[model samples]
Target: MKTIGVVDTTFARFNMGSAVVDEIKQHVSARIKRVTVPGIKDLPVASKKLIEEEDCDLVIALGMPGSKDIDKVCAHEASTGLIQAQLMTNRHIIEVFVHENEAGSDKELAYLMEKRSREHALNAVKLLFKPEELVKQAGTGQRQGFEDVGSIGM
Candidate 1:
């Protein structure tokens, strides 16, 4: 069975890890491992550990950046680290970052978190089991948390 890792940050207001796990369980049967860190910057190492030590085939790194310039910078730094980790491990890390400023209200923020996490979880499943599904979706403007913009007419 394949192992899927879920790395989340405690700094996030929502429990995106649980949302991802729940979505994954609905689609396929795989070993799901979860790790929690203090902040987004910690996601890279946690994800690497999950891949190298826990034998995960793929990872979903979830984080929420606050609505501030410094937070955005930190998110970018974390994203860079995640990319490096993926290069070093030669594995896929599906990043699910929901910036606090993306939503106008608290309720919307929570909804976006759950929706994005679940959608990315399904993407992970498709990547591991049926990558062709994604190929079919290429250029479809498939948004996770918001309404999909749809494909443009030729």
Candidate 2:
């Protein structure tokens, strides 16, 4: 029953962006709102809006890569000269904490994300956030993603 908020920086690609969003929607079952603007700006605003409007239990920002792995965006300051231009005006990311702390660590990423999502779900349960409504969403098969996402942790 946890209301999770999600923001994605993949929309600059337009149709492809929306398609990616659709896939994520299926995967996360979280509240997602279309955002304008380019990269980092869209993310922070989307994150804030989703939290405020959805009363979200958690906020996640998603960024797609044009020429590199998602991790690379957080890895080198600039993967290539072309990316440097994008980073300058886009997800500037002067210091992305997740990358700075977790990079090259032995931790299993999928597991961590799942664990985090489950913790949010559990918190929603503890707060008596909205069991019956969530149950109905379950009836429609939308309630299982968070559990599966959390399973990535284990």
Candidate 3:
């Protein structure tokens, strides 16, 4: 069994990604490690290296999508948030996510979060069966899917 980390980020300048990681763990296997609510970010490079080197299994990153404007909803925003956040899911397996509180509590914000969550969830599913199929499963989001999940404005 692979040990996986489920992390959530909050207190960002925007609220699009918060309070949602809890909801998406439903599908992962019971053995997957669930990191508490503390966001994963700003770890020392050495620390980050250790986590990656720990040989856990996967370093799944989650995120929420919130924007008044339009974007393709890739894994980039989540990746940036991950680097800037104070938390990181350093494990293997799954990084399931769902949207909770975002930008303005507007319906659009909610919709985007949910959409991103679904993507995360779906990606998790694919990871389970494929594992090495990331490039095929994940879109061209710079560094997310490796980002932590947070608020959804719910």
Best by lDDT: 1
lDDT (Cα, 0-100) at 127 in candidate 3: 61
Show the colliding residue pairs in model 1: none
TM-score versus the correct structure, for each prediction = 0.98, 0.31, 0.43
Clashing pairs in 2: 110-152, 111-152, 111-153, 114-150
lDDT of 1 by residue, 1-154 (tens): 9999999999999999999999999999999999999999999999999999999999999999999999999999999999999999999999999999999999999999999999999999999999999999999999999999999956
Q: 7-118 in candidate 3: lDDT tens per residue?
A: 4445222232232334335555523433333332322222234346543344345433334232224334444544543256433333333333333455655565555545
**Tens-digit lDDT track for model 2 on 25-113?**
44445454444335543455555555556565544444323334654563343234224433433322111112212223324433333
Q: How far is candidate 2 from the true structure (C-alpha RMSD, Å)?
A: 12.5
Quick one: ranking by lDDT, best first? 1, 3, 2
**Candidate 2 vs candidate 3: which has greater lDDT?**
3
lDDT of 3 at 134: 71
* Ordered list by TM-score, greatest first: 1, 3, 2
